[model samples]
Target chain A: MAQFMDVHHGMKGITADQLREAHQADLAIEKDEGVHFEKAWADPESGTVYCLSEAPSAEAVQRIHERAGHRADEVVPVPLTV
Target chain B: MAQFMDVHHGMKGITADQLREAHQADLAIEKDEGVHFEKAWADPESGTVYCLSEAPSAEAVQRIHERAGHRADEVVPVPLTV
Candidate 1:
């Protein structure tokens, strides 16, 4: 399994509730894509959100986010974590 | 308390040992700046690294990284997490 970090841009000023709901959207159907979204962090001031997940591929991670109503602007493989 | 995500660029082929060593370097003296580096992720293919930390300010995070020898290219406050 590969770990992925996906970034959502232009979501500035997102509230805590909105962030949770967006994350929940991904979790709702991640299983179909073999993705597990572990956590999401957002900087409301910058309007950016970052999500960390374990998935078969970066595409799988993107797919889950897209289906959840937001598409990730960037998805990078984080093969090394410490 | 705030969560920050910092990015490091131009280290595209960093090895696992190198990554761990770099992280350890930051951990070795993080307390001096009141920063706690929770984890780090690297994408050797893209030569990008992302760090997650709880810090008093983004500057403190950057200071620790700079002192550790790998200055972050970008640092953003991720005050919201889920």
Candidate 2:
């Protein structure tokens, strides 16, 4: 399993709960795409959300986000420590 | 090496070159701490710098940053995708 962290920007100045709901909604899509969300965080000040997930590919990650109605600012692969 | 991303904020509205220099300095510290830097990025508008690195522990990551004379806003573990 490859780890990925997706950084999202321009959340439309949404509230924390609202953002959480969007993320939870996105999580559902991720599950459908065979991705597992290990953890997630949102910065209310910056309206940015960071999500850590395990997925086969970055494309799969983007698909999940697209299906959930949010576009990522950047999606980077996380290499495991040796 | 486990890949971790460090998100930094409040860069005092520094320029990209300045931030990059700071990051390069930080990378030297990481190398000394047995960490390998994969990639790093900075957003001038938000004054955010994100770094990808491989390290055994988050504490080690923090130490590298401190040694470089910068503070991290957040450091989240990236779970490998399964």
Query: How well is each residue in A1-82 modelled by candidate 1, as lDDT tens digits?
Result: 8999988889978999999999899899999998999999999999989999999999999888988989999999999999
Q: Could you say which candidate leads in TM-score?
A: 1
Please report, as a residue range, the 10-residue window in candidate 2 chain B with the lowest summed lDDT: B73-82
Model 1's DockQ score: 0.94
Model 1 spans with C-alpha error above 4 angstroms: none
Off by over 4 Å in 2: B1-5, B8-82
Model 1: per-residue Cα lDDT over B1-82, one tens digit each: 7899999989989999999999999999999999999999999999999999999999999999999999999999998999
Output the lDDT of residue A51, model 2.
Answer: 73
In candidate 2, the residue pairs with backbone N, CA or C atoms under 3 Å apart (3 or more residues apart, or in different chains) clash, namely A1-B81, A2-B81, A54-B81, A80-B1, A80-B2, A81-B1, A81-B2, A82-B1
**Pick by lDDT: which candidate is best?**
1
- How good is the docking of model 1, by CAPRI class? high
- Candidate that scores best on DockQ: 1
DockQ of each: 0.94, 0.07
